[model samples]
Target: MVGSGQLRLLAGTLCAYERDGLAYELQQALVYVDDLLVVGNSMKGINCLKSLLDKEFNIKDLGELRYFLGMEVARAAQGINICQRKYALNLIKDTIFLGAKPYSNPMDSNAKLYEKCGTVFKGPSKYSRIVGRLIHLTHTRPDIVYSVSHLSQFLANPTNLHYQVALRIVKYLKNEPGKGLFYPSQNNTKVKGFSDFDFDWGSDLDTRRSITGLCFSLVTPSFHGRVRDKKQSQGPQQKQNIAL
Candidate 1:
């Protein structure tokens, strides 16, 4: 496929292809150094392709995806549920924050955090590490994306206020560490979207630049933020179709 142009490498470890036997018009495979995820619309075709790849490489089909990266996958007649249950538990254990009481909310709604308002965190490295893990947690926990994103900004010089807020998120995670993103396999797969942006909503104060909050949700939420000019902050275009 690579030589015939049926498949093209999108980037390192990611490839896009089209197979005559595939159920969909396009297919994709991702490589994580040693492992590969053969994804497409047709299970039969996926297995067949896996067989062919196995002939040339030491490839193995581990059956339906139950775990990938840190996300756990569970499939049933009703739907497919994905979560970071194990990851979340391990995170709490690693951070030594398992003693915290669960919080209903991830962050304080009334709080408007900025760099200048709190006591400086002397050793901000741990804060940065905690924020990094929280960022990954947002994969299955859309509920905490905003809170984590807000705390991420203080990575360079986090404050005690920021660390406390980040801990609040950890507490929130404790509320339901096994909670996940569930997509009904029986429902219509049409793409639905929701988005919002605050145009020059407020000032960063530290940078003397206006701040903007831009976020969008299809089924899983993903977002970006900055103080860029209007033209630089437009919505992203869908580059490929997604199937749950």
Candidate 2:
């Protein structure tokens, strides 16, 4: 035989093995600390790999993948649906806006957020903590991303108005704690992108700088940005090379 007892490189966040040239068509074992998730296209191959792991180590077979890293997994004929309802509920419970009424929109269209106009928050640490948790919640809830990005601007010196808007975002979260993006398990998922920018929306009283909001989304990393600039002319012509 090759060896009597040969166990090598059995600890890692991700593990993959392939004897043939095909790598992506084979099995995959993803591990987060102690939680191990074995997955593959074919159920027969998956079970065989899992059995080897269980025999070598003492890993308990949880069978199917349901929940991992705050996201719930539900398998079906159409496709797999993922959500973070439990995580979102727990997040609401941990915050001060649990009992608050829900709202339809994450942000107020009439509300214009000026940086240095409102009264300063006495407890900025609390505001920062809430914003941090909200950022984590955005992992599954992209709907609140605009609101969270808006609130994050005032982290250095958050005002009462900013804090209120942050609470409003939490209230938005209360609308549907189970609401999350559905990622259909299929080949050929199309990618789409759109960008928008504002032209000197509001001018700061002290600095004379204007506010600009820019947003763009890629396949994975979707982000929005707020820029303070004095140049107001030809804002749209700046990025003419960007395709879409």
Residue pairs with backbone overlap in model 2: none
Where does candidate 1 clash, by residue pair? none
Which candidate ranks first by TM-score, i.e. highest? 1
**Highest lDDT against the true fold, candidate:** 1
Every model's TM-score: 0.78, 0.68
Error of 2 at 80 (Å): 1.7
Candidate 1 lDDT score at position 130: 88
Q: Using alpha carbons, what is the TM-score of model 2?
A: 0.68
lDDT of 1 by residue, 6-121 (tens): 45667664344554664354456766655566787666655555655666675545556666777777666766677888778888888756777788899887787888768998
Off by over 4 Å in 1: 4-6, 13-25, 197-200, 203-244
